[model samples]
Target chain A: MTKNDLEQLIETHGNEIYQFCYHLTGCREDADDLYQETLFKAYEIRKKIDKSDVDSPLLKERNYVLGIAIRLQKNLYRKKSRRKEELLDNEQFEYQTELASDFNTEEKVEKDQILAYLRKIIHSLPLKQRKVIYLFYFADMSVKDIGKLLRIPEGTVKSRLNAAKNALRIKMEEKGYE
Target chain B: MNNEEMIREALKLNIDAPEEINEKVLRNAKHKNQGVVFFKVATLAASFCIMTIVGTGLIVKASTGKRLIEYLRGLIDNRSYVYENGTDTIMTVYDNNGEKWEHVEYLDDEVTMSHPLSENETEYNLYLKVTGENGMEHFMNVTAKVNEGQSSEDLYWAIRGDFYRFFSPYTAADEKSQILAGLKEAADNADKDFIRDALIDVSADLENNRRILYEDWPADIWGGEGRYIFFEDLSDLPVGKCIIIINTVYDDEDSFIFEINIDGNQLYVNDVSFNKYSEEYYQEQLEKNLPIYDLR
Candidate 1:
C-alpha cells in the first residue's frame, strides 16, 4: 500500500482506532501514544500487503489497521505489566466527570454516572476479558471477527465475553445496581 | 438498561479522539516512513560499495591496506590493540594489574562481541565470566548502556558502569567464612530465632545474586509466588544438628545449591555450587514423577 492509501485509511478510521486505544488503556496519554505507534507500525509494514489489495473493501483495511492496534496494545500491556504499573484510576474518574458535563438533564446525568461506573468496571477487568469487551461492545466486532483478530477460537471469544459480563454484573450488584 | 446497551452507551460517549491526533498521527507516520526509506537507501548504498570493492582487484587490495593501517593505528593507541589474524579480529586490552587480555571480536563463524547493539537505548545487566589469575572462573554482574548510534566494539572497550561481584566459590571465600562465623555463633547459643534470621539473610543475598545472574525466574517453579529461596523444614531438626538447606531455583533446569552444615553446633556453608541439568534429564525425571530438587 502507498502512503496515500495509509493516509486515507487513518483519516477515515482514526477516531474508532483512537477510541479502541482509549478503552484499551483507559487514559488519553497512553491512548495517544498507542494510536500514534499503531499508525507508524501500520505504515512501516504496509508493503506486506499487495499494492493491488489497496482496492480491497474499506472494512478489511479498517480491520487490518485495528489488528495492528490490538497487537501493539498487547505488547504495551506486557511491558507495563513487567514494570508493575497500574492504570491511573483518578484519570478515569476525572474523564468521566468531564464527560458528564456535556449532558444537561437529571436523567442524562444518572445515565452518565452509570456509564462511568461501567467504564471503570470494564477497565478493571483482566486484559483478555477487557479486550474482548472492547472489541465486541465498543468496536462493534462479531465474536468470530474478534477470534480472527486475536487468533483465538470463536468459542474462546464467546467464553471471554461471557466471563467479562459476569464480572461486570457482579461488580454492579455489589454497587447496589439491579 | 441491559448490559449490551449500557456497554455500547458507555463506550460511545465522548469517544471521539482529540482533534489534533489525526495530524499528529499523520506526521508521525510520514516521519517513520522517511526513516525507513533512508535506512533502506543507506543499506543499499553500503551493499553497492562492498560489491564494487569486491568486484575490483586493486580496490580489494586497497581495502586490505586500509584495514592494516587501522590495525597499526590501534596497536599504537596503547588503550587497545585491534588486529586480524586470518579470519579472527582480536582486541587486546590490559587489565588494572597490567595483565594482557585478548578477546576475539570477530570469529570466523560468529561475532563474539561483548555487547550487542539495539535500535534504542537499552540497559543490559550481564554476568561476565572472567577467569582470574588463579585460573578460576569468577562471575561479575555489569550494567552497560548500549545507545542507538554506538557500535558494539565501542561498547566493549568503553564499559564504565556499576559492577558487582556476584558470588564466586573461590574469590569470595572470605565473605563466606564471615557468614559461617555468624551462623556458628547463632547456632552455638541454641538461638533458633537467630539461626532462622541468619538463614533468611543468606536467602536474601542468594536471591539478589541469582536475580542478577538470571533475570527471568520461571513462574512454574516459583508457583507465581515470586519467591526463589525455599527452606527445607528447619523446625524438625534439633538445635545442635540444625542443618539449614537453602535451595534457590533460578530456572527450570538449574538451581543455586546452598547447604549450611551445622553438625553439633559447628555451622558452615558447604559450597555455593551452581548446578545445571540437561533438558532431557529434567523431562525424564518429571516423567518419573520425582520432585525437581531431587534431580540435583
Candidate 2:
C-alpha cells in the first residue's frame, strides 16, 4: 500500500481501531499509545504486502489492522507485566462521567454508571476472554472470524465467548442490573 | 435491557481517536515514504555483507577440517530444546574457558551415563567435546538433571542470568531515576497504598505459573555468599521487608526466593534462597511426560 492508500485506510477505520485499543487497554493514555503504534506498525507491514493483495476487500483490511492491534497490545501487556508497571486502576473510569452532552441528566447518569461498571468488569476479565468479548461485541466479528484471527478453533472461540458472557452476567446481576 | 443487549450497548459506546494521533500518523507515513528507498538499499547491502562473511567462514572451516556445530532440531536461542513429547526441556550449550559443555534435559529418568548408546547413536549418547586449537579432543559425560533432582545451588547458576537480564532494564540510571521520581511523587502525596500496589502488581505479573511469597529475610538463606547480588549498598536507609519466592520456570523441583527491601525511595534486593521440591512430584511430572511450561 502506498502512503495515500494507508492514509485513506486510517481515515476510514481509525475510530474503530482506536476504540479497539481503548477497550483493550481500559485507559485513554495507553489506548492512544497503542493506537499510534498499531497504525505505524500496520504501515510498515503494509509496505511489504504484495500490491495485488492491497486491493482486497475493506473487511480484510479492517481485520488486518485489528490483527496487528491485537498482537501489539499483547506484546505491550507482556512488557508492562515484566516491568511490574502499575496496574490499571480506578483512574480509567474517571472519564465515564464525561459522556455526551446531548443526553438528559438521568439518562446520562444511568448510562455513565452502567458503562463504568461494564468497563471495569470487562477489564478485570482474563485477557483471552476479554479479547473474544471485544471482537464479538465491539468489532461485530463472527465466531469463525475471531477464531481465524486468534488462531484458535471455532469451538474454543465460542467457549471463551460463553465464559466471558457468563462472567459479565454474574457481575451485572450482582450490581442489580437486570 | 437483557445481558447481551447491555454488553452490546456498553461495547458500542462511541469513542473517537484523538486528532493529534491522526496528524502524527500522517506525518510518519510521509516520512516513511521518503526513507523507504534508503532502507531497502541499506538492507540489501547488509544482507550481501553477511552472506559474504558467512561464505568465507564456512570455506575456512571446511579447509581447516573443523566440524560444523549442528544444533538439534527445534533448538531455541541455543538454550532450550523442545522434544517431540511436548516437553520444553532446558538444553544449554555452555562454553567455559574454551571447555565446551552441553546440559541436555531428557524426558525420562532412565537414560544415564552408564546406559548403552543406541545403534543409531543420533538420538541418545550425546557427548560434550572440548577441542583445542591443535585438535586435541576431550570428551565429558553430562547428565540430565531429571535423573538426579536438581539442587537449589545448581538452579541458582542456571536461572540467575536470565532473571538478572529480565530485570536489568529497570536497573539503568534513567529507569531508576524515573521510578524514584514516581515513588517520590506518591510519597509526597502519602499514597503508600499506591507504592505497595505497584509492588504487588510487579509480584502478580511475575507470578505466571510460579509461586511468590512475601517473607522475612533469614541469614541462612544466602549463607553470607553474595555472588549473585544485584544491589548491595542500602545500609543508610530504612528498609521494609518484602521477599519474592520464585519457582524456576525451567524445572519444577527448585524454588528460589530473593528479598526486596524498599528503603525510602530506593529498592534493594537482599539475600537469595533455593529450596527443593519433593522427589515424588518431579518424578510424577516426568512419568506423565507433561511440559513444565510452554516457552513459546
Candidate 3:
C-alpha cells in the first residue's frame, strides 16, 4: 500500500478510535495522545503491511491500529498511579466537584443515595481491585479480556473481581448502606 | 443478589465521546493503508495457495466426517481451550477469561446449541459484548420484534475497525458506524431509560454458528450477509403462539432471559421453564412429555 492509502484509512477511523481511547482512559488528553501513538505505530509497521493487504476487507477497515490504540491506553492506565489526570473541560469538572460537595448536604438524598454510595464503594477499594471492578462492571468486559490486557491469568482476574465485590458487600452491610 | 440489574443499569449509562474521533479513525486507516499493500498481496497469494492445498482436502474430509458436531462441541465447550474460533458460526459465550460460561437458564424449547433460533417475545434485547483477551470491551445491540407474527429488526453496532468490506457491498461497516455515532450523538442528555430502550433487540440469527447447537436442524435457520442478526419475519404466526429457538451467534452463554407477553387473547408465559419437559430432564419429562404441547 502507498502512503496515500494510509492517509485515507486514518481519515476514516481516526476519530472513532480516538473516542474509544478516551472512554477507556476516561480522559481526553490521554485519548488524543494514544491516538497519535497508534497512528505512529501503524506508520512504523507499514513496511510489513503489504500492497495487497491494503484492499483486504479487514485491513481496509479496522485492524492493528485498533489493537495498538487499545493496548496502549491500557498500558498507560496500569502504569499511572497517583497521577490525577486533569479533566480538560473545566465547567463540567467544576460542576461535578460542586455536586460532590452539595451531595453531602442533600435533599431527596435517600432516593439517590445509592448512586453516591456506589461511587464511594468504588473509591474506597484498593486501586487494582477498583480497576478490575470498574473495568468489569462499568465497561462490561469479560475477565479473560481484562486478564489479557493486564497480563494476568483469568483466574486471577476472577479472584480480584470477587475480592472486590466481597469487600464492597461487607462495607455496605457493616455501614447499613446495603 | 441480582446485581445483574445494577450492573445493567450502570452499563446503560452513556458516556459522551468527542465528535472528531471519527475523522481521527479515518486518518489512522488511511495512513496504515500506505506501504501495506505489498504485504496484503503476499498474504493473499499465500492464503490462496494454502486454500487450494487444504480446500480440497477439507471438502473431502468434510464429506467423510461425522459433521464436526461431536468433535467441535468437545473442542468449543472444552472446559479449557482459548483461542478465538472466529468461525463466526460459533455463538458460545465465556467468562472474563476465555472459558465457556456454564450459566444456564432453561426455557420451554427443546433447543440445541447449534441451530439458528428465532424467539418470539413481547420485547427482546440482546447485547453483544467482547472483552479483549486483555480486558478492553466492545459491544453491539441486536433487537427483534414479534407482533402480528412479523419481526422487522436485526441490527448490530459496528465500529470502524470491525466493519469489513469498506469498498465492497459487504462493507456494512460505514453504515454501522454512522448508526453508532448517530446513536451516541442522539443520546446526548437522554435519560438512562431511553438509551436502554434504544439497545433493545428482537431476533437472534447466525448462519450455522457454532454457538448454537441443534440435536436436529429444526427446518428453520436465518441467514444474511451482515455482522449483526437475521430475523425471519414473524407476521403470520398465530398471535399467541410461541416457538423457542437458539441462535447463539449473537449470544455465547446460556444466561439469557426471554420474556413473552400477549394481552387477553393469548396465554401469558414469561420465561416459561422447561426443565420438567426438556430432554436433559428426561427422567422426569418421560412422565409428563405428551401432556405439554398436547394441551393445545
Expressed as tens digits, the lDDT of each residue in B105-175 for candidate 2 is 32232121111111111221112222222433222221111101223333223222222223222444443
User: How are the candidates ranked when ordered by DockQ, highest leading?
Assistant: 1, 2, 3
For all predictions in the order shown, the interface RMSD in Å is: 17.5, 18.9, 17.0
On a 0 to 1 DockQ scale, where is model 1?
0.16
Per TM-score, the best of the predicted structures is 2
User: Which whole-number lDDT from 0 to 100 does residue A173 have in model 2?
Assistant: 87
B1-296, model 1: which lDDT tens digit per residue? 88789888877745566668677656655654443221111111100000001111110110011232232222112112122112334333223111122222333323332221112332323222233344332222233333334333323322211111123132355444433343333234332342234334443443333211211111222223322322232323333211122334333533432212223322222212112234543443345332223323
Give the per-residue lDDT of model 3 (tens digit) for B1-296. 35545433432323443446545544545533331111111111100000001111001110112222222331112111111111122234323222122111111111112111111112222222222223322222222222122222221221110121110111144333433433343234223342323332101111111121111111111112222221222222343323333332343332211112212331112212121123433333334322222111
Worst 10 residues of 1 chain B by lDDT: B43-52
lDDT at A175 for candidate 2? Answer: 90
Cα lDDT of candidate 2 equals 0.47
Give stretches of model 3 more than 4 Å off. A1-26, A35-70, A74-113, A116-127, A170-176, B11-13, B32-296
Error of 1 at A121 (Å): 0.3
Return the lDDT, model 3, position A126.
54
- Find the 10 residues in a row with the least total lDDT in model 3 chain A: A86-95
Clashing pairs in 1: none
Interface RMSD, prediction 2: 18.9
